[model samples]
Every structure is written in structure tokens, then in C-alpha cells.
Target: MKRLLLSAALFVSITAFAQTYPKYTNEAGTPKSTSKPPAARLKSDGTEMRSETVMPSRITGDFQEIMERAVIQNKEHNYAAAISLYTQALNVANEEQAWRALVSRATTYQTMDKPNLDKAIRDLTTIIDAQNAPQKQLAYIYTCRGRILQEMGDIAGGCADALKAKELGLPVALMAGLEGCK
Candidate 1:
């Protein structure tokens, strides 16, 4: 089931699209994508290599509704609205759903113009403190935060995060090794 509403994007996608999209667009939300991001990625090789946000088949109810709306707002570049909805989703979401929303929010804040580095790290760190998501999920968050820290000139913090991500099996951290991350 899909519903479409237009708005601006802040951090993440909502819950109603069937197509999978790459993670985020620029702060301006150019080169628009028409689908929500997958909570998980394709962990296989060969012809199966592609990037997209895959929604589970069973998402339904109010949590789903909020997430879907948030996606719409995010895609439409209604960032403030998207953030509010994601926050609303938090109040209703279960443990797994909360993790998803937090990831979405953290990524959003990290990427938005005049990126909120502190808020982004705060959200990512909350997830880290929980340690509830699977290792791959944690690895992804680490890389996201690491990139933010690097951008903020916290090379040590960023490198630590990148190294942690690498330790958790995401080789992308190695690729994220900015100039001083040796």
C-alpha cells in the first residue's frame, strides 16, 4: 500500500513507498528519489550488489503511518516537519522501531545544511549506548557519526569511530579514512 504527499527532506524517508532509495540526497534534496531508505542493505556479492532502503513487508499501524508521513516530508524537503514526525514515531515505536527512527533521525540531522553535529552524535550515541541493533546496523551508525566528526574537525573522534566501524565489519570505514585518520 502506498500513499504520496509532497514535502521537504531533513534526515530520512517515511514508510509508504515500494521502491528502495540510496540513503540521502543533498540538503537541497536535489535529484529527488521516490522511495524510502531500507533499514538493511544487500549483504551479498555477484549480481546482487545494489544500495537501497528496504522496508519490511509487515509494517503497519500508527507507527508505520508516522514513519510513512515522515518519509514524505523528508523527500519533499520539509525537514522540520519530518523531524517532528520522527520524534512522534519515537513515542509510539517499539524497541526495533525506535532504533529505526533514531537511525533515520540521526542520519537526517547529520546531513542537513548547517548540519547539527552534536544532535547527530547524540542520536547515534543513544543507539550505541543501547547496543540493541545488529552489528551491521551499529557499524553503519558508526560510519555516519565518524563522518560527521571528521567534518567537525574531530579527527581523533572520527578516526576512532571509523576504526570501530571497521572493527565491526564495515570496510567502508577504511574508505572513509580521511587524510588524518591514519
Candidate 2:
């Protein structure tokens, strides 16, 4: 009957919607997380507790903590915080991580202030010239450089770099921004 089909369809839709968000798990193979940040943990006494396994506040040696902060700030469009965190991260970032962070932070800079062409160019240039960098990353470097140049009034150079990036296997998303740069 029509009612039976409608009920089944409603159940399927509800199931799909409920499954959209994944369950969180702890590093020690435990479940039942409350979807809060790792800093909020429960103790045996039913009070809030802070554990090394639950909270990674000790990730201070290298740029991991700073990079995580930068990534989160970038997602939230907090450009100043992202810039500061990325700067701290770059101080300890290895060659590989620095290159990626440069690109990411440069993007945030561009989004924050279109007039910050110099900062964007500097970041992209650093990435493009990284020694022994991965070829795929090189493609991304070219794309970022292309955007910087285009924004800085170097139309021809930007288009050239954009074309080279696509030829070097940058994704369509990167190339899509390159459109009209010519």
C-alpha cells in the first residue's frame, strides 16, 4: 500500500540523515565520546578530567600544535590567528610541512586582504622554490604563485604559471581559479 511505501521511504531518509556525522573515538580504542573537543574528558568521579591521552596540550615540541591551531583558525576565517599560528608553525615546520602551510596561510591572507599581494607572493615563492619538494606539491606551488601574480597585476606571468600548473597535474579546482587570469 501507499502508506507502507511512504513509511519505508521515511525510515530510509531518517537513517541517511542520522548517519551523516560519524562517531568519535579515542586513541585508546574507546568509544562514547560526546563530540566535544579532546580536552573535555570524564573522570571516575563523574567530574571533568584532563588526561594526556585525551588532551594533546603537550604537543609543543614541533609545529603540530601550531599547525592544528592554524588549520582550525583558517577554517573559522580568523585570519589574524591563522597568520600567527602559521608563523609559529613555520618556525618549526619541516621542509614538507612548511611548504603546505605557506600555501594555506597565504590563501587566508589573500582572503583577508586582497591588497596583501606581497605577502601572498612571498609565501608562494617560498613553496615553489623548496628544494626536493614533491612534484604534486610543486604543482600546487605553481598554482598559488599564479594567483599571487594575477592579483599583483602580472597578468601574463600569472597565466603562464597557471598553465604550467595544470600541465604539471594540478587539480581542476586550482585551475578553475586560474580562469580569466589570461
Candidate 3:
């Protein structure tokens, strides 16, 4: 009798859990259309034109795992291990993931006890030079790099990046540093 009641309770809990959970259509199921609709382009004649949806290449599972581990190491203050793991993740990263990994590494550099701000600038520069990410992300990166430049006494470089970020929709230049930036 006790076993029967326990079994009933387990079944009820499972049913309740299943019903409350949102359905996922990904794993071992039909493919899902996760891509956003392509932007419409106008020809010289001003006619509506359809374009293919641009989907970025997905990063590898290994990249995900390595980044997760790196985050854990970073939170634990294991700077060396975290940086090494972040580098490993970079080697396996795809288009979008490339920016993610680079930014993460740059931040790690910024947070180190004896911070390597120069290396941080280099990593952020790699992202800016790539010019492959969305405008919003580029804006954020520019803002970050600009702040770093300001700290490093490069007022002109900071102003340039800050202005670029403003052009990209994040107007933080004047607030970050007013030096040589009108």
C-alpha cells in the first residue's frame, strides 16, 4: 500500500512538471527556424527585393564547455587557468563566438591583479578590426576600448573610439572622458 502511494505521488509530480515545462523543439526533434527574417533591399528602381537569411556559423560544443570552465576559473580567481581556457575556446569559436571569447579574454585581462591593459586593448582591437559583429555589439566594444584608452592616457584614441561608439548608437564619449572629445 505504501509503495503504491509513493508511485502515485511520483507520477503526479512528473505529470505536473511536464505540463509546466515549455516545449522545446530542438533536441532529437524537427529543426527550428531560429534565424531572423532577412532584411529587404531596394533595387535602383525602388522595387522590394528578397534576400537570403544570414545565419552565423554555430560554435562547437567544445567551445561552449571550455568557456563555461573558463568562467568558473575566472570567478574562482584562477586567472592563469581561465585565460588558458579562454584561449582554447577561441581556437574553436565561430563567427559570433569569436567576439564573445575575445571580449571575455579582454575583460579577464582588465580584471587581473596586475592588469595587462595593453593586451586587453589588442584583443578589443581585434574585434573592432574584424568589423563583423552587429552595430550594437561594436558600439559596446568601442566604448570599452575607449575607456581603457582613457585610463592609459591616450586621450585622442579614446575620443576616436568614443565617437565611433556614439555613431553606432551608444553616446558615452562625453561621460567616459571629456578630454579632447567635443
Candidate 4:
């Protein structure tokens, strides 16, 4: 009789738990649409047209506000505040957005007194080396790393990074100080 009761209790508990959970559809629904709908090109009639479901501006505005605050702190030479804000942004940001914040914060560290220049260099270098990093982004990381090395008086290493930046097609102007070091 005790065994029968225990089995009933287990079955009831499992049923209750299962029913309380919401059903997930296809693992959060089919993968997000990658391709844009066909462009709404103007017809000869020239009637006005627009895409359906415009993205909300508030989402982008929030990210921009956070990034702007980080930039302002860096400009004011408040490295700690800038780094903190950048980290907050990174936590909520997409892949490209996070990379931008990390690169900016690394530069802020280089600009601070008694800066951990080696760590800054390493941070930028790792981002540059990322296999999936966007192509245009590699130049920016190399430029930042070069500046940190140049500031620390490692002319040879700085020049190498600067050259790498240039080879990646960044404008020569970004490597201004390292030009002579080359």
C-alpha cells in the first residue's frame, strides 16, 4: 500500500511540473531571418512606399547613450569611469559592439598615468587576431596597440604594429608617430 502511494505521488509531481512550464517552439522559433525582403523599388506610378516593421529607435538610442558616456569619460581622462561604462556596454552589446567597447577601454588604460601598457597591447593584439573579427576592425586594433607600444618607448615593436596596420589598409595618418620608427 505504501509503494502504491509513493508511485502516485511521483507521477503527480511530474505532471504538475510539466504542465507549469511553457512550451518552447522550435528552440525559440526558427533562426532569425537573415535575408532582407525584396527591396521596395519605386514603380512608374511613384506611390510612396516603406518597409514593414521598422526597427525601434529606442534600442539603438540606449546603446549610443551608453557609448557616448564612455567616450566623454575617456575624453575627461577619467579612465576608471570610462572603463566601467565600456564594460557595461560590452555586457549588453552584440559581437561588433562589444569589440568596439573593449578597444576603446584598452586605449583609455594606455592614456592613464602608470598605464598597464603591456596589458593594453595584449588586449588589442588578441582582438586583431580573432579569426571571426570583421575585416575592417583589424586595422583599428593594430593602430591602438601601436600607440600603446610607442608611448611605452618600444619603438621597434610599435613600428611593427603600425606597419601591420598600414598593410591592413588603414590610413597612414593613424601611424603618425610610428612613421619615423619605421
* Candidate 1 per-residue lDDT over residues 1-182, each given as its tens digit: 00011111112222221133232212322222223323333455634433222333333346667888897988887777887777666555655556667777776675465566676777777778777566776776776677667767797988898788778986552333333665
Q: Report the C-alpha lDDT of model 2 over 76-100, residue by residue, as the tens digit.
A: 8788889777766655454445554
In model 1, which runs have C-alpha deviations exceeding 4 angstroms?
Answer: 1-61, 173-177
Looking at model 4, report the run of 10 residues with the lowest lDDT sum: 52-61
Better of 3 and 4 by TM-score: 3
C-alpha lDDT values of all predictions: 0.59, 0.57, 0.64, 0.56
How many residue pairs clash in each candidate at the backbone level? 15, 0, 0, 0
Compute each candidate's TM-score over C-alphas.
0.63, 0.59, 0.63, 0.56
* Candidate closer to the true structure by TM-score (higher is better), 2 or 4: 2
Worst 10 residues of 3 by lDDT: 24-33
Q: RMSD of candidate 2 to the true fold?
A: 17.9
Kindly indicate the candidate among 3 and 4 with the higher lDDT.
Answer: 3
Error of 3 at 106 (Å): 0.3
lDDT of 2 at 20: 39
- RMSD (Å) of each candidate, 1 decimal: 16.1, 17.9, 19.3, 25.3
lDDT by residue (75-156, candidate 3, tens digit) is 8989888887777666566555566667778878877777888778877887888775567767767867876787788988
TM-score of 3: 0.63
Error of 2 at 160 (Å): 1.7
- Candidate 4, residues 125-171: lDDT per residue as tens digits? 64665433455557656766765676677768778887887788866
lDDT (0-100) at residue 21 of candidate 3?
Answer: 28
